[model samples]
Target: MTDIRIDIREKVFPAVGQAAAHAAIQDFHLTLHSGEFVCLVGPSGCGKTTLLNIVAGLDRDYRGEIRIGRQQALPKIGYIFQNPRLLPWRTVRQNIELVLQESSAGNTVDFLLEAMRLTRFQHVYPERLSLGMSRRVAIIRAFAIDPELLLMDEPFVSLDPPTARQVRELLLDLWRKRPHTVLFVTHDLREAIALADRLIFLSPSPMSVIGDIRVPIERHLRQDENEIEAFRRRLLDGAPHIKQLL
Candidate 1:
């Protein structure tokens, strides 16, 4: 497990011909502690993805520093995108096996495939699997690397309610077993409440942290709609402004 410290003073995208330069993120920063699950919640197109890109070291045309633990070099990072960006040519098992850097990844690959209930589809390619099934494969691939820090960008965005809930359970199950640092980006406040140990709210673009809190209800109680609704009511009663964006 590793602690991540991020300090992004600004991130700007250059003008595209007639369009003006857009500042997606400015003065954005976050610190993720070792082995904790933290969710960044904000409105759509609010630069949540941009912040993840900075933290993941994907976009470098920014002014800031991101330090994972004590190292200058990056460790093995596992990322799950907004879509199942699996290699179409590869089998489910093969897609997972590709990112592995060591021999021990085989055992992990086997365990995660069985755990995600994708053993029967291990030999199937991405094109053949349903959306829900493909999402399962993506989850397996992310965990197969046994990464120290996992970054997820709305991994359950388009799924139907039941399927999304199932996938969320599977992800948390993997997180519990692996126990590593996770920086999950999401727009759904309810989903954030259900998944995170701590939740940080962000303002709409040129975003910055507006509020932060630990989940009041236990993980087990989160599934009960009554409890979830009650918590939401209590929270919103105190801060009516947040309800508008959420």
Candidate 2:
């Protein structure tokens, strides 16, 4: 893990033909320390995903500076999107192997599968697994890449509450074993509180950092109902705007 700096003075998508340039991010500056978990929370369509894309180098038509590690060589990045985006035809193990190269020698896949409790389903196809299982496979795949930074975009958006909680627990466990710089984007305030070491609130569209709050409780203590409720009440009392996003 290494220090990463994101300094985006402005990011605009050029107009195609007669359309006007769409501004997605403006004057957004953030620095993430090694192995820190930071969550980006904001309203719908607030360009949270766009910011993640820019950081991931998926979108280049933007004005910004994103520096990774200490050198010009970009660190490995693992991205998990809203959907699992798995190959329906591939088995869970095969899907995990897809991102692995021959030169990359490690027991990462085995370790991740064991840690995530996915060893039993290694031979299962993506379509045969439940939504939760599919999402878990996607997560394992990301970790298999042995990334220095992990970017997740609403990874548990559509699951039942119980399933989502399970996934979150699994994520925390994996991260505890091997921490990486994580930038997670979601609109769920409670989820943000549960997972992030720091919470970054963004404005609507043409998003910019509006607030940055550090979670005081330890990661293991986050699952306590008393702590969660207390944090929720605190947010409602001090940060009403964030409560309204709920």
Candidate 3:
């Protein structure tokens, strides 16, 4: 059994002053085993990102108990946002190396550069790199830390379809090589279905877990368009609210 279990009891927050109190996450409970890849999908403002923030310990203002294994969930979180938040002054390798430096895990720099296919542009600054390369660098920076949990907030949202697909493939390959408990938040149902071992659907604002669907298809089949499409259709059938989002 994996050494991670997240239990979110009740998380409520005020919505910009207080016209009405909005429960960002109400009775949200999720159990994620280690080495599991879970994707969260929902309509906009459904508290998907809010839930991730709670798990990451970015926002402890809410009420809940988040635990990893027998210990309280520590702050060893790696976040990959929609934008490739890289420093313009630093080169690709330098940016990745900086993350390693924080942990004193210098050995991972080379491996991450190779894994992310950023070796060719190692010395290039963020401005010199293309959007895809910058995104890859951000991913490497996140993984370089060897985090216990990785939280991705629609990491590929800014890319074109082809670039996004490539990044997704790269992400899966890296995840396979170094398994970690991952909570990925995305609006794309197909992307979520392709990459996740389990699919979690959130309702509209003041989000709650409305559906939990296990994707039985093999992760290796993610590259197969037909299989991915079929699985996506099945997932949509299970979560009709998701279909409404489209």
Best-fitting candidate, scored by lDDT: 2
lDDT (Cα, tens digit) per residue for candidate 1, span 60-124: 89988888778655656888898989899999989898888667777888889888888888999
Alpha-carbon runs more than 4 Å astray in model 3: 15-18, 102-106, 238-242
lDDT of 3: 0.81
lDDT value, residue 246 of candidate 3: 53
Ranking by TM-score: 1, 2, 3
- Give the worst 10-residue stretch by lDDT in candidate 2: 66-75
- Per-candidate TM-score against the hidden true structure: 0.94, 0.93, 0.91
- Specify the highest-TM-score model's number: 1
Better of 1 and 3 by lDDT: 1
For candidate 3, write residues 25-89 as lDDT tens digits. 77777888777799998888878888877787788887668776677756488999888889888
Those runs of model 1 whose alpha carbons end farther than 4 Å from true positions after fitting are 70-73
lDDT by residue for model 2 (58-92), tens: 98777777886656445799999998999989889
Which of 2 and 3 is the better model by lDDT?
A: 2
Q: How far off is residue 176 in model 3, in Å? A: 1.4
Itemize residue pairs with steric clashes in candidate 1. Answer: none
